[model samples]
Target chain A: MKAFAYVNATNEREVVAALKTDGIALPLAGGQDLLARMKDYIDSPDRIVNVKNALDTTVTSTPEGGLKIGAAVKIIDLYENQQVARMYPALNAAAIEIGTPQIRHQATVGGNINQRPRCWYYRNEEFVCYKKGGSRCFAVDGENQYHAIFGNDGPSHIVHPSSLAVPFAAYGARFRVLGPKGDREIAASDFFTMPTLASVLKENVLEDEEILTHVILPAPGNVRSGHYEVRYKASHDWPLAFTTVVLTMNGNRIGSARVVLGAVAPVPWRSKPAEAALAGKPLNEDTAMLAAEAAVSEAKPMSGNAYKVQMAKTAVKRAIMRAAGLKTV
Target chain B: MSDKEDRFGVSRRDFLKSAGVGGLATAVTSAGVTDVEAQAGPRVIGPGDVPVSLTVNGKRLELRIEPRVTLLDALRNRADLTGNKRVCDRGSCGACTMIVDGRTAYSCSTLAIDVQGKQIRTVEGLAGANTLHPVQQAFCDVDALMCGFCTPGFVVATVALLEKYPNATPEQARRELDGNICRCGTFVRIMEAAMKAKTVAGPPTRQARWGDMGVARG
Candidate 1:
């Protein structure tokens, strides 16, 4: 890593102000992803603003009978919170399955959601993919095995690398963003943008001076939610395919549902067809199979990622079954 | 199998035992009163050699380093605490795992300046001069290590896991040790050593003052 200056921010205002300073001051949360990028020379900032202690790290009950999680809360604490384990199982499940226990212990929620893309081509300094404002996206023709299979209209093919974003999007959470202008809230679903020729530089709309401070989750009233991931390494590896399902139940019938898939797209691909299939139908094996098929119906895989379509379908079906209290493989 | 390589490869355990005499002698005043007091104010380390004080193994060692130095690099290069190996400099492999502020963390990813006042316990901190820590002794008795490049990191991680879950279940053990990768495939024996080692507790961390745990700057 290159030698850079370090500034420690004392509070939220200081964090935003520090980031707004000149010379590309990047906020350091857990430093798990940022340090790796620095070592790889992907990002060589002049100064690092330590924001781990600057952001709120609490998880408390909101006035609306919902849960409000501070952006800096560690992943382990989020997974082990008794109320979170009881109320939001999908969030808890995603938190636990993120990385190894040591990583989950040190990595923060804000860092997880704000992490950069993990494309091998992008992570390597030589490729100079489109995300880096380069001439072309190497994944277009080069070894694109782990590239996106959905939302492939992109000039870039890097997948969003947050496991928490899947469940947070499924839960309809909103982010309380802190910026120099003040706080603004953005829905979790709309926070991630599809890659375009114009907006290929960043995955989220968070400006350089803005910080995602809090994630406010409205109470999932009478809802059944589940999350399942398919990793080639059954141990600690990034998901090859994952799915999260949140269904508002009306006495054994699905009133509304949100199904989101990860690692198969640039953003968390919400399968509207799967949600429509589970709209008024009862969740059983047949309906789950139908929803699974609908989830992968529109997957446009690249050359080496066609297998993710089937794995995503299995993950969708298993997530629905797990949400319904059924035995799943 | 080179004779020169075998003779000069000094483990952190032996290095610490040798350096303990000189380190404790210099720890008389704790990095000077004014320097320690400067930590409470605003900290902005710049493109110079910044003074950093670390409480490693209950001994305070002061070093002037750059802000970009990681804890692993500082300990190994500056302090000569080479017990913690640097196998996979990224956080993927846990060769540089160390206990910081009562939590097991990847020292390769943790910046040295960011962890100034926190208590750090590395693999070298586990044993004493005349005796071995139970975890180390168990590894030896069970023949859990081969080639020993990754032993110190695995030992530190095992110490953390056993402290968190004394009688760790098989699943919990697997999950906790997933961060460390062993190419030697000595996992069965390593897990056996972890299970056999007694529930060892880490040194008690200094509790923050009342109402002072809120925004820890640097």
Candidate 2:
């Protein structure tokens, strides 16, 4: 690996100041992804701003009865956090579903949510696709088995890799961001964007000078949430398709619902049709099947990823059923 | 330079003539090989070397290494502790598994500087002079190791699993060991060893085990 200058920023101001400079400063949180990329020569930043020492790693309860998860909170911490387990079990399950025990212990929650796309072509550093500012997307005609099926409008087909972000969006979590201007809050749903709308080279709306501070989850009440993932293999592999659902039930009938799909779209694919199908209806096997069908109505599968449609349907049905405390069919 | 070489050449022959008598005198004085053949020169520490202090096997070691050196490379190269093998330099393989601050981590993927003050336990640190660690004993009893190349990592990972979940069921053990891979296909034996270790270790303290395989309550 090429040698680079390592800078340990003392505070948010120092981090933003360093990021403002022109020399390509990469922020290092858990170093789970950044260091690997550096070793592979995929990213050779001249300087690395170490944020592990700058941010707090604690997970605390907010005054509003929600969780305030620091950006540096490790994935293992999230999996074992008592408040997170009680308030958002789906988030905990999603955290556990990421990588392995070692990666979980070292990877931070903020890093996981902001991780680059896991597209094979983008990660290889050899394929110069449209996401890398090239003329065309390699996955469009090449190996797209893991590409998006829902939110691909053109030039890029990479899917968002964060399992936690799906549940975050389902729960309507908000992000606390720090930048050169000042601190600002953005909803998690708006934080992740599509390639067609945002810059093709970037995955989210985060600027190079900004740092994600913490994630704020609302207070738990009548909300029932769960996440289900279907993957080829369970170990250190990205999910083929997954679903996260948050439902507010009026006794046995669903009052409001939010269904989000992961690894099947450019962003967490929020299915309004599925949400509409669940509203004002009892969460039964038949209703879940209808919701699942509605979730995949607009899915346009690539050449090798038609099987993911089935996987996504199954995941959505299971997630909704689990959230409703119903058994799988 | 020529004059210096001529002077050194004459002194070398004179010194060699007296070296045999001096060698015998020194050997008699020290009762060992006094004129042993020269081996290799010492390795030089480079400018990029940084001082790192780590606690390994309940012992503190201060080592000088490059900032980019990984924990696996430091343990295997500088410390001469080769138990943690580096199979896949990526985090996919658990060949470089080690317990860092009571959690299992891939040493190959972890930077040495990142774990400055953490307690690191490698496979070599598991056994004493007379007794083996419980996990190691179980692995041996169950014949869990084939080819033995991945045994050290598996043993270390098992130790971590047992530490976190003492009463892990067979299915929980399987899921917890998912991070570890055995190319020799000793997964069944490894799982057996893990279950046996859980039986010997008794119940977990307070943490609940995740995954559908185990129905154990916290």
Candidate 3:
């Protein structure tokens, strides 16, 4: 690992001021991902501004019935939080499905959502793919088994690694960001960025100086949400394909719906067509199948990842049925 | 108290003799001492002194180290707590499992500074003077360890699991133990040891009442 200066920022202003330096100054949250990246030499910042002590580690319900989760809230805390488990069970399930108990305990919600992609090419310092400012995306032809199947019309093919962000996006969550300019809120859907060769070094839309403070989810009313993940093993591995669904029910018919597929795209792959298929329609076997089919219609799977298409469809079908209070296989 | 006189009332010749080049070189070569005035230029420590305070095994130790110094290094090197072995520093192997604030964490991935104020319980802290913790005793009883290098981490992780989920099922045990890796493949025996420890520790206080109740009500 490369050597770096360390700064312990005690407040948000100190954190932002430290980030304004000329040299690379990485923010250390839970260090679950940042430490791994440093060890891999993927990131060698000249200074690491520790932010674990700067943020509040609380999760509370907003006056408008939404949830406000601090950036430093650990994933284990999210699983054990009564408010999160009661109001956002999908988020709780997603938290439990991350890495392992040890990693979950050390990893924070902000770090998990802001985590780097888990693509093998991106992680290994030896392979300088487009995500690393090289020529092409290595996963396009190389071992592309876990690469993206949707939203891959880009110079990179890595999938988003956050399991919790999918539910957050499905529920229309917003981010409270702090930077040199001050605080601002952004919808969760707008937080991520598609990989473009124009700027290969950037991961998300947040500027290098910006720090995510909290995530705010909209009020839960007439909305049923759930998440289903298909993984290789029960042990805290990343899901091969996962689905998060938020449905508004009108008597027995679906009034509105939002279906987001994780680990299948650069960002959370929102299936507007699938949502349209379920809108104003009773969620039966046929409608669920149609919605599942519609969800993956735009999927362009890379080599060795054709199975993801099927897995994604099954996940979407099960998630839709689950949202509608129907039985799923 | 006079500026012209030596503080200890030593002569100038004696002070010059004590500050000789030989003495300066000896100071530079000493284990933990450095000669500040003998160098031709200001000595630089490099970006290698990252000061971190770690509370490990019920002791608060302050160490100046590199930013890359993992919690495993801070524990085993600075604090001299070698119970948490550093097998795979890349976080794949679980030889460096330790309890931080009532939760099991991979010390290899965890930075020492990150766990400054938290309570860190290493495998060394699990046993008393002569008696062993239930998890440690069960490991010995079931012969769960082969090389014994990974035993400390396994025992610590087991204690953490049982503390959190006292009645963890076999499948839950497997999932919770996924972070720990034993090269000897003593997983079955380790599972047995964990289960045995669970029984010896008994169910948690909340679940004990349910355990006393029969199937049928009055």
Candidate 4:
């Protein structure tokens, strides 16, 4: 990595001020993503602001019976938090399935959500894809086995890499961003923007001078949620595709549903059709299969990723089954 | 040049101005002694070599290095502690796993300066002068290593696991050790060593810790 200055920020003000510098000043939380990108020369910032000590690291209960999780809370703590396990079990499941034990012990929630896409073309300095200021996405015509099947209408074909993002969207959480002017809350579903020709360099709506401070989850009332992931390697690998389902139950029938898919889109792919299929219908094997089929009905699979369509369907079906307390297999 | 100028011939005032730290500089220069820290912002350290202190194996080691130096590079290249090998420097492979503040972390992805005040433990700190740590001894007794490039990280990770869960279940052991990879396919033996070490290994006694060398003498 190239030489850079370090800033040991003590608070949010210092963090924003440090990043407001003339040179490129990036926040360093956990260093799981930023440091690796630096080593690969994908990013060469002049300053690194250490936010591990500066940001809030606790999970507190809001007056509205919701959770306000500080950005610096480690993934392990999020996974083991009893409140999260009870209230937002889909998020807890997603947290536990992240990278590995070592990664969970160090990586922070903010960093995980803000991590760059793991598209091999973007990671390798040689390819210089659209995410890297190049003309077009190499995954368009090149190897696209792990690329997106949904939301590929954009210039970039990279998948959003955060496992926590799907559940965050399903749980109706909002992200609080701290900036030089002030702080603002963005709905989790709207936080990630689809890639455009102009905004291909970034995945989320966070500005350079801002930091994501907290994730606020509204109270889950009368809801059952489940998250399921499919990966080639059971030990440690990114999921081929994953799904998180939040079903609002009205006695025996489903009142409403939120189905979100990951690794199949540039953003967390929310299937309105699947939600419509599940509404007012009793969750059974047949209904679950219908919802799964509806979830992938619009998937535009690439040359090499047609298999992911089936895997995504399986994940959606299993997520619904798991939410309903049924045998998925 | 005045004493305020850095080695790069840029005056501190100009440097601060160019770096957009004029506000912090004004605050630091104008604030009262009691109110200084409240007004002052984060202090910028190196784009050059700067002093960094680390507590490794219960001993403080100091070095002057550029801010980009990772903990793995600092320990292996500067502190002469090379037990933790750097195989995949991007934090995928766990060959550079180290225990920091009672948790196993990827040292390759961790900056040396950022971990200044944390207690760091590596594979080198596992044994004492007279006897090997129970985990190390178990690895040998079970023949859990073949090529051995990945052993130090596995040993460190295993020690952390056993320390956290004395009688770790098979699933727990698998999950904890999943970050590491062994090309020689020594996993069965390694798993056996981990289970055996759970029965034999206890917390390191006072005698089981190295005095100051930060390595086992044997």
Candidate 5:
């Protein structure tokens, strides 16, 4: 990695001031993703603001019976938090499936949501893909077995890499971002933006001077949620596709649903079609299959990643089954 | 500037020698840094070689290294502690696993300067001066290693697992050790060793140096 100055910022004001330097300055949270990217020379910044000490690292209950999770809260603590496990089990489930034990121990919630794409073309120094400020996307005609299927309409074919993002969107969370101008709350779904030619360099709406401070989850009332991920490896591998289904039930029937698919799109793919299919219908094996089919009906798979459509369908179906308290195996 | 020159306008070698190049030493009390500390502002380290103090295996070891150096590189290249191998270098492979504040972390992916005041337990610190740690002994007794490239990482991860869960179940062991990879396909033997080690594994020898820094549980 190229040499960079380090600031162990003691407060939020210090963090923002340190980032307001002449050159490229970035915040270092867990360093699980940023450090690796630095070593590969994918991102070379002049200064790094260590936010592990500066940011809040706690999970507190909100006045509305929701959760306000600090951006620096470790993934392990999020998984082990009893309140999260009881209230937002889908978030807990997604946290447990991330990377591995060591990664979960070190990776923070904000870092996980803000990690870069796992596209091999973008990561390798040789292939100058659109994400790397190049005009062409190598994954378009090149080896793209792990490329995105749903959100391939853009110049980049990389999938959003956060496992927690799907559940966060489903549970209606908002991200509190702090910047030089102060702080603002953005809905979790709006936090991640679809890749365009102009915005191909970044995946999120966060600016250079801004830091994601917290994820505020609204109270899950009369809802049953489930998260399921499909991976090529049972061990520490990125998901092929994943799904999180949050259903508001009226006795035995589904009143409404928030169905979100991950790793198949540039953003967390919220399937309004699947949500429509499940509305006013009892969540059973047949209805779950119907919703699953609707979830992948519009998937534009790449040349080599057509198999992910089926995996995404299965993920949606299994998530629905889990939410319905039915056997998925 | 010359290739040998530091950003601080001094020869790199001379700076190292003056800053106590050996991995263990005193905190940097440079005039510029002391002046910076006098201000009511956050202390910034360096793009140059700056003094960084790390508590490795309960012993405070200080080094004058660049802020970009990783924990794995610092321990292996500078501190002469090379038990933990760097295979994949990325966070994907668990070749450079270490326990930081009673939790397993990918040392290769963690910056050395970021982990200044934390308790860092590496693979080299696992065994006694003469005898092997129980986890290390179990790996040997069960023949869990073949090429032995990923052993140190596996041993460190296993020690962390047994420490966290003294009576680790089969599923727990599989989940905890899933981060590491062995090309020799000695997972069956490794599983046996982890299970056996659980019986003999004792309490954590030392208390965590810092008590949950910045973390407040709700």
Candidate 6:
């Protein structure tokens, strides 16, 4: 990595001041992603403001009996929390499936949500893809076995890299962002943006000087949520495709559902058709298959990633089955 | 002659001011920066060679380093501690695993300044002058290592795993060892070593020297 001035901000106000300075300054969260990007020459900042000490790192219960997770809370610590494991099982599952134990110990929630695209073309220096302001997205016609199966109508074909964002979006989590102006809350679904020609450089709506400080989840009343990820390797590999299902049941019938797919799009792709299929339907194998089919009905796979469409459908089916307390095949 | 010019001759101040190099030289010294400290604002160290004091294997050592230097580089280069290997400098291979604040962390990816106040236990601290830790002994007992390049990381991770779960099942052992990768493919024997390894009895003979630096969060 190139040399850069490092400042340890003591508080939020100091962080704001340091970030507002002229020149290229980047907030150093877990540095799991930023440091790698720096080494790869994807991003080189003139100044790095360390915010681990300046922010809160606790997991607390909100007034409405929901959970308020600080941005700096480590992924391992989140899974080990008693209330989180018992109350939010989907989050706990996602946390465990994110990376290895060492990564979870070092990575933080804020960094995970704001991680860069995992497209190999974007990471390598040889191929200057659309994310790097190049003319074309090399993954479109190049080796794209891991490219997006949805949200492909773009100049960028990278997938969202966060495992927690899937479950967080399914549960209607809101992110609290702090900037030079003030703190503003943004829904998790609205935080990630699909890649367009104008906004191909960044994946999220976070400003240069803004930091995501907190993730607030509402109460999961009369609802069951499940997260299932399909990885080729069971040990320390990114998911090929994953799904999180949050189902609210009215007695034996499903009242509403939120089915969000990860690693299939530029953002957490919410399947409205799947939710519509599950609405007021009995939680059975037939309903699960129907919902899974609806979830992947619009997936337009690239050249080499057509297999991911089936994996994405199976992930949705298994997630729904798991939520209904049924054993999946 | 102009009225503003020196009446007698080109005075010393006028001559020096017209040269322009003198002004730049004076600007350098007027900032009150001595030889040791840089002229920058605030008391913090820099992107250049800055003083960093850390405790490794119960020795509180200080070294001059840049902010981008990782803990693995600092330990290997500055302190002559080479037990932590630097394979896969990214967090992928976990070849530079160390116990920081009682948790397994990748020393290659962890900044030396980030864990300034925390307790860091490298593989060298796991054994005594003559004897070895239970996990190390178990690894030797089972002949769990082929090429020893990845031993330090595996040993450190095993030490943490035994601390968390003493009687680890096969599934638990597999989960714990996922962080460290062994290209030699000694995972079968490593699993045997984990199941047979006894609990870490007491404080390590070479305990880490932890100062009250008010632990910096990872």
Best by DockQ: 4
Calculate the i-RMS of every candidate, to one decimal place: 16.0, 24.6, 18.7, 8.9, 11.8, 14.9
Q: Which of candidates 4 and 6 is the stronger one according to DockQ?
A: 4
Model 2: lDDT equals 0.78
- In angstroms, the error of model 6 at A327 is 1.2
lDDT tens digits, residues B1-218, model 5? Answer: 23333332323333222221000001121322111112355767789999989999999998999999999999999999999999999988898999999999999999998888899999888889998899998888668999998999999999999999999999999999999999999899999889988877454322222356754333
lDDT of each: 0.81, 0.78, 0.77, 0.86, 0.84, 0.81
RMSD in Å for model 6: 12.8
lDDT of 3 by residue, A1-329 (tens): 67877767776666665554444567788788878877876666666777788776899889999889988898889899998887877787778888887888888888888888889987886675555445668887799999999987878888988888899999899988886556789899988778776544455667546788899988878878778889997665789999998888898888999899999998888999999998999867788899999999988999899999999999999887776667887
The TM-score obtained by model 2 is 0.86
> Tens digits of per-residue lDDT for model 5 on A38-117?
77766666678888898889999999999999989999999999999999999999999999999999999988998888
* lDDT of candidate 4 over A141-199, digit per residue (tens): 88999999999897999899999999999999999987755788999999888999877
Question: What TM-score against the true chain A does chain A of each candidate get?
Answer: 0.99, 0.97, 0.97, 0.99, 0.99, 0.98
Chain B TM-score, structure 2: 0.69
Candidate topping TM-score: 4
Per-candidate DockQ values are 0.14, 0.08, 0.11, 0.23, 0.20, 0.13
Which portions of model 1 miss their true places by more than 4 Å? B1-43, B198-218
Native-vs-model 1 lDDT? 0.81
What is candidate 5's TM-score against the reference? 0.89
True contacts kept of 5: 0.39
User: Native-vs-model 5 lDDT?
Assistant: 0.84
Return the lDDT, model 1, position A250.
90
Q: For residues B1-218, what per-residue lDDT tens digits would candidate 2 score against the true structure?
A: 12222632222222111111100000011112212222232222222777888889999989988767889999899999999898878888899999998999989877787788899999999999998898887887678898998899999988988888888877667667888888999998898788877776565323333354765553
Tell me the tens digit of each residue's lDDT in model 3 across B1-218.
12213432322332221211110000011122221122232111226776678887888888988866888888888878888898877666678999988989889888776678889899999999998898887887667999988888888889988897898798878878888878887989999888888888554322212345553442
lDDT of 6: 0.81
Please give the ranking of all candidate structures by DockQ, highest first, separated by commas: 4, 5, 1, 6, 3, 2
Off by over 4 Å in 5: B1-40, B201-218
lDDT of 4 at B129: 88
Range of the 10 consecutive residues with the lowest summed lDDT in candidate 5 chain B: B18-27
The residue-by-residue lDDT of candidate 2 on A1-329, one tens digit each, is 55655556656556555443334456777777777766755455555666777776899889998989988899989999988998998898799899988889888888888777778886665564555444568898898999999877866888898888999999999998876557789999998878862367667777546788899999978988878999888666889999999998899899999999999998988999999999999978788899999999999998889999999999999998888778765
- What TM-score does model 3 score on chain A? 0.97
